[model samples]
Target: MAVALLVALTAWAFIFYVNMIDEVHDSIDDGLDNSKLLIIHQANLDSTVLAKQSFDEGNYAIRKIEGHHALNHYDVYKDTLMYMENEDDLEPVRLLTTVFEASENEFYQLKVISSMVEEDDLIEDLFYSLLWLYLILIVTILAINTVVLRSMWKPFFKFLNHLSEFKLGKNEQVQLLKSNVAEFKLLNKVIADVLESNIRSFHNQKQLIENASHELQTPLAIALNKLQLLAENPELSEEVVNEVFQTIETLQRLTRLNKSLLLLSKIENKQFLNEETIDFNDLIKSLLLDFKELIEFKELEVIFKKEDDLKVKMNPELARILITNLIKNAIRHNFNKGKIELLITNSSFQISNSGSDKELDSTKVFQRFQKESTDQSSTGLGLAIAKSIVDISGYRIEYAYSNSMHQFTVKFD
Candidate 1:
């Protein structure tokens, strides 16, 4: 738009200058023609011959020309510079030359002149005035359009803010997007419908998981009790007792799996809303102590390195789960008699443990029931549960394998 305005201004100025100059030339030519007729009429009235002389006013000249040269009798006008006595300098002027027969066998050539200084001054003034007017008009229009556009897009920014703050399990109902613009209104409607459908589906899934996990707990306990009684019976055969023990172990695994699934569901559903300031170093130390027996059984070496006090805000249960899963995973997957390294900083916790030569599958590591090896002891939902907690807490977790060690890092922000 600015470029266009500049071009328009230049074109208009050029055209205006050309037209004004033409008008000034035309007026001068008309006066010259009239003066030639007047000079002839005056000569005829007094019956006197026209003489070659210049007027004292320095505006016109009469020159008696030879008849042979005057035969062509062509009239012409030109711009020229002439010296003026008062100014002591040559100034621009328009000169018109015309020849007429003043008497028999005689020709008179008349030259009429006019100063162009006044015309140039007038044109300069006119050009500046038009330029300013055009600039003012363009600037005013641009400013007004800027204000109008900002107001028009206000609703879109509002909708974006609301979407950023939206969360599952938020008690507030979805706010209907309202706007007068057709496109914006349509967008709002689509977003509202999609969110509503998703919320309903999430609630239904959460209810089903809660009901199934809760309902299975009672029967699982009774089965374990019955298996225990059968194992204590002295009359039972040795083979039968062994089979019952194996059955009991399978049921125990099922119970652990059930609990993990329920915990994962709860984390994903955002049920843990509690927040407390936790010293991550202390929590990690406490969790390591709880796993001291398992660590000893694995014959693994544990090292804790702290550079700063690692304090963070999150639900106490979730925080505990995140750290516990990380440390326990390290222990469960480590090489026999290998080493485990724990590092704590102001904003992060990292655990590196000796493991297999190959890296774990990062894509499937966070998925439920995904495991790196056939480790029957693990329900294979440990990392998945930890990831759910990290996600709901608005923290980040990363996994990597380097230096023959499996590394898991959690960033609290």
Candidate 2:
């Protein structure tokens, strides 16, 4: 609005200045023309009027010129500087030059001067005046804009504040104050509909996951228990016992996979909202204790280096899962007697393990079921779950392979 006003006022000022200059010149020229006619009339009535050669007391002068010189001559009005004895300085004045026929074959040239109007001074004064006017108009506009726009947009800003506080599937609801504005009222309605739709979808997804958890795990558990009992029976043949044990193992892996998939779904649905400041240094130490037996069985050389206490604020369960999965991955994929390096810093947690000689596909490492290892027991959801947790927590995780080691780094902001 301010920019538009400036452009409009500038154009108006230029046009007004031009028109005012034209009007001033027109008024002065009209007066000079009338004076010229009256002087010519007097000169015709009395010859003495034509005898004046210079402007001594009057504002006009007459001088005779040859007929050929006056032929086809047009009256001209122009600005010129003339000496004024009263001011004792050169003053700007308007002059009119015209040719008049005094008698047959006789022509007199007349020059008439107008009272001085210093156009430079006029332009300077007009510039200052217009400048002040533009300033006043802008200030007034800004004042009105502050008061009126603030009042007009109060409901919109308040609505946004409430909307920001609203979370899907949470106890809190977006509570907006009544507004007189039609657009704001419509906005409130649309937002309410969208939130209701999302809340419904969230509840449906949550219920489905819960149902799958109960319905699937119960049968898997019963089958595994019966298989283990069959393996315990002395009547069973060696081959049958081995087969039963294998079946139990497969069912166990399936159970783990189901749990992983359900967890991934929950993470994607933004179900975990609880958060706390988690110290990675302490978390990693605690998790490493749980993986000590496996690490030792692999005969891995573990190198733990801590430069600082790495800390981040996120859901405690998810944070534990993220670190645990990475640690398990590092130990599981590592070759027997290979090296594993764990580094902690103020803002990052990194773990690198010696695994395949060839690098894994970085693009597919974080994707579900994209396993890089030959281990059939691997469910391939460890890295995917870690990645999901990092995403929800607003952290970043990256994969890189260098010096025949697979490295996963989780960076916190």
Candidate 3:
């Protein structure tokens, strides 16, 4: 914008300067013509006497004279032309003459000369003054614009700084101070609405999780205890005992799934206290060791690699729950002879499994209530739990599929 304004101003100044010069040129031409006519008239009255007197007074200097035609020089005085080659400090001027017969035996010769210094100086002064005035005007306009723009944008800058410092999950309410501008006031109102909606949604979801967990606890415990009594009965047949054991396994899966869901909700609510230094590498290795029996039972190959002691400050319980769900999910989804690999580094931890489940859409796998298969024992809450942990801990989780392998990577920075 500034550049465009300067270009426009420069173009306008150039056009005005040119027009001013043309006016001065025309005025000089008219003056010179008029002066020549007057001098010729005066000389016609008495050419010899006036010529000789002009020469003596150095007002007219004759270069050459013929009967009625002569070539002379004129020195331009205040508003009149005089013939002088070396008078005062003025420059010498030359003129052309032609004799014309006004009547029989009567003739007149005219000389014309013009000085352009005064006219040139007038045009130069006008252009320089205009140029300086234009510069001052542009500078004044720019200064006013800077102050106005900064004043108008002050509220926006304050709003942005306030928003940046807000912690979403931790802070239940956000307040914005009133602003002078109408636009800023409207913007603040919109932000307040959004923050309110988020808080309401979070509380509603948290209440649902807690309510569901509490309602399922009593029934699940009673069912497990009943199944245990049936399995321990001495008179029970082998087939019946086997059936009871199957029921207990299904019940156990439900209990574990419910617990995981509740934990995920808590994490989302920012209920987990993160106040301890934890070695993430050590946590992953320990989880793998604990799951050795299950890994062996499935006849799965386990590969573990550790690059560095990755340390982070977080809730130990939440961190353990996060890693446990990831490892369990990998083991459960693997093929009979498939391999489950865990790679740990300073910045990231990755779990890869050699299994193909085309029905699984890797992109939506982390969404709550999304199940990869119709296995009744699978709660479809593992990845959701992992995502909650990742979000609360300020980490990132991503899934990828390549060469018939499924990989889940968590990065911490």
Spell out the clash pairs found in candidate 2: none
Candidate 3 vs. true structure, TM-score:
0.63
lDDT of 2 at 223: 95
lDDT of 2 by residue, 56-86 (tens): 6889989999899999789999999888888
- What value does the lDDT take at residue 12 in candidate 3? 90
lDDT of 1 by residue, 1-413 (tens): 55676677768767876787788789877877787777668766654435537745657777788998898778899989998878888988888888877778877787878787886687678778777876786778668766877788777777678777776666436565567888887887788788888888878887888798879988999999999998999999999999999999899999999999899888887777668999998898899999999999999999999999999989899899888998889998887799999999899999999977888889888988888877787999999999889888888999898888889999985
- Lowest lDDT sum, 10 consecutive residues, model 1, at 47-56
Best by TM-score: 2
lDDT of 2 at 39: 96
| Candidate 2 least-lDDT 10 residues | 168-177
Question: Which residue runs does candidate 2 get wrong by more than 4 Å?
Answer: 65-71, 118-124
Top candidate when judged by lDDT against the true structure:
2
Local distance difference test scores for all models: 0.84, 0.89, 0.75
Q: What is the lDDT of residue 268 in candidate 3?
A: 74
What clash count goes with each model? 0, 0, 3
Better model by lDDT, 1 or 3? 1
TM, every model: 0.71, 0.92, 0.63
Q: Could you give candidate 3's per-residue lDDT for residues 270-363 as a string of tens digits?
A: 7675459989887887888899999989999988888877887878998898899899889888888899888888888889897766536766
